[model samples]
Target: MRSLVLIGHGSHLNGESAGAVYRYAELIRERGLYDEVVEGYWKEEPSLRQVLKTTRSTDVTVIPMFISEGYFTETVIPRELGLGHQGPVPGEGIARVLGGRTVRYTLPYGVHPSMSEVILARAHEALPDLNPGDTALIVLGHGTTRNENSNRVIYQNADRLRESGHFAEVHALFLDEDPRVGTWPEVVRSPRVVVVPFFASEGWHTLETIPEDMGLTGEVTVFEDHPSGSQTVYYARPVGTHALVAEVVLHLAEEARGASERGGDEDRTHAEAWHAFMALAQEGVRLGEALITPHGSLYEIRHALDEGRPSDALTTVVTPEGLRDLTRQDEGGRHRPVHTFRNLPRGWRAVLSVTDLPQGVHNLYPAVVEEGYAHHCHSLRATPWPTTARRQTGIYAKVSRATPEQVEAVAKDVCSRCLKTRLWAGEKLPRTFFTRVPGAIPCPEACTYFIAEAREEVSGKRSQGGHDHG
Candidate 1:
């Protein structure tokens, strides 16, 4: 069996950061090329460390959904996947024999040559009527001085676009380094300008920061009385969110799969764990806000609040992707990154064959089945709050400064908002930080959202003259 895993850099503040990755995974799954297609996130649940546990395939190819080969691609991902410190192999990625399976890691999607086509397509689609010869195109990236490769792909694409001669002028801009995005008004001399974000997904950067920095009022911002003489600025969506990204991912995975050497028999750990979960589901199981009930060979999952309703009465979803979209938001349309949140909207049911239950449950509450099985086997590792906090840097570094009382306060506040049973607690927090419901989903550590809130509380207290034990 073969599998494809798409890794993304999810966000604690914005749930939309992983949206493109999930969409791409779903699109690829629809093609029925691989036995399994799953998604992992660096900052979200079903994280890079745990995603492999959900795949039963012997030949697994992992493609980072990021736009560049930077810190995450080079260091963090390998570390999380237990792939050791092996370096890339020119075109083919690091291949290793892991737990009786052949796992091949591929470069990020953005570095591929086909991405230039995606960028051009997005630019043209944004303003089909505009003449490319008269408009200047700017590719925006989040460049970092720490990793030169972070901006390398953006420059390469800009050069490619210049070679295409489709645009009158092409410029590459970064959010962190030189020729910043804010200087786009001065950098391009064309009467019409198109700015395409080279990042993955629409998050705080694309949705909020980039627009504010570029002085863009909307998708098509027109400046009637500007210093550049009535310039019209057209902003395209991030290149990574384009539909062609799924094709790029498949190409990357197929390339790695062809180069990979088949090894020992497939590991049955993940498959066994999944089967065990299915066996448990046969009787009936409550996972977070979802209630799974067996109906002979098939199973029906619905919101716990809608347990009494018939499947036909609720909004029925047959595919895992459809169920994922349906439950991505709450009743009021707020994004729910923490899927185990108690606020699952009422009157929605998912009908799945036994074969589809794994993906279906994963979309509803990621890694719940695998983690639950590990917990049952007494092998699940939970990261303590202090350990998770000490690993934080940058804006979240202040989280380590939180007092015991402040830590407990933040834990209580955040846990109350989530449905998962906390398995990791601080020194000050009791084992029962919150009442653990029977069949409650497991939270192995303090989530990114909780950490962000803790950082805010710590920073606020410090500003208010709170004593710093550190």
Candidate 2:
């Protein structure tokens, strides 16, 4: 059976981010849809690269468990896995593979047809008394200045729902551009309208801004004197936790399977192999490290070549000629590096500690590892990484040798790096509950505690703009 990989845009700070993906992976695994199912994240452990190493199925299908078909779906995941539609070399269309490993990539979770069910479910929950001519539904999404495609998906969902004739009106509003959610009152003529968030998780904007801006109370409420004196506004929960999301993953997997099967006649270009080699090298680049000349790098290179992106190989090099010269110099290399990288394949497993908190890993963990994946007890656990680390109440990663306290420090370090990036960019998220003094040196010593506490505080402060996950 094929291995199914679920990739999430995880958070080092918010443990729930990873929890959601794992939950879905487990659910799917329980149904026996795939022989092997695993979870990986862009930010957290058992990363996309490493998670790939843990699976041994001849065929692999990757589903991007993101909320939208934006950057992470379009750029980041593809960049990481070396999959996309491109011809080989200058003349022929070649089938390129990743490090000689053949895998198919499906569209993200957000763009799947199954999402319509969640939207309809949210709308129904928002307006139970709805009958046709009375209540309207407004889907709100956090449109980005960076990617217009994000809003496009939201609008498309709106259109699909609108065409279904479920509500008197179904429209979409964005946080960034025109037809904004804050200005939604101007466009609506309905007496009562349900506002549903089109976000992945109940993060800052959905929990705070839209409701505050729309003059809502509780998760669902109505307001008068907002649009017209008769108009009532109700806010609904985010569409992330719905059961229909699984269908979305299946749909994406099918698409990837089709594409991979149809592209067999393509040429064999070493571009993918070259690209993978460069990616591995770049990981070590920050430490001023370089990859071994021939065999050590060949596996990733071959994978890339099979996937059909020779140009990526060319770009991975500091100089294209340098990479070409290296490949030519060692054209007769052996597969010892491949043997070193390949290991015993392991299925997805977790030992979660549950709690009452809604946002922490503790709550999300049980759900993520529920049905599809395996649960490991302390003694039978595959690695001690889950036990040794200083774990936040809701988070886990594979750090075998480290103590729990050491893992806690690593978590804090990830948060600190992200915080530094935010500061350097002079950027502000849509909903921020607390702000540090400008140029304040963040104390890294208590970083994990601060991150968990800061997010908890932010989630509780809905009036200030952060989402209330609780």
Clash count of each predicted structure: 0, 36
Q: How close is candidate 1 to the true structure, as a TM-score?
A: 0.80
Candidate 2 regions with alpha-carbon error over 4 angstroms: 84-96, 259-470
- TM-score of each model, in listed order: 0.80, 0.55
Candidate 1 Cα misplacement greater than 4 A, ranges: 85-91, 96-98, 127-136, 144-147, 165-168, 180-194, 202-235, 256-266, 310-313, 385-387, 397-406, 416-422, 425-443, 460-470
Model 1, span 1-470: residue lDDT tens = 77788998886546667778878987998898877788888777677767887777777888988888877788778867888853443467778777677888989888988899999988988888667657999999999998778888999999999998889999999999998998887778888988899977776799899999988899999887767688888999989888999998877876774454342345587777777777768878777667889988888989887878766788988888788889877898866767776788888888899888878888887877777666666666788888878866557778998887987787677677776667887222222211223345567778766776787787774223222121
Instruction: Tell me, by TM-score, which candidate is best.
Output: 1
**What would the per-residue lDDT of candidate 2 be over residues 339-371, giving only the tens digit for each residue?**
111121111111111111111211111111111
User: What lDDT, from 0 to 1, does candidate 2 have?
Assistant: 0.50
Q: lDDT of all predictions, in order shown?
A: 0.78, 0.50
lDDT of 2 at 256: 64
How many clashes show up in model 1?
A: 0
Lowest lDDT sum, 10 consecutive residues, model 2, at 335-344
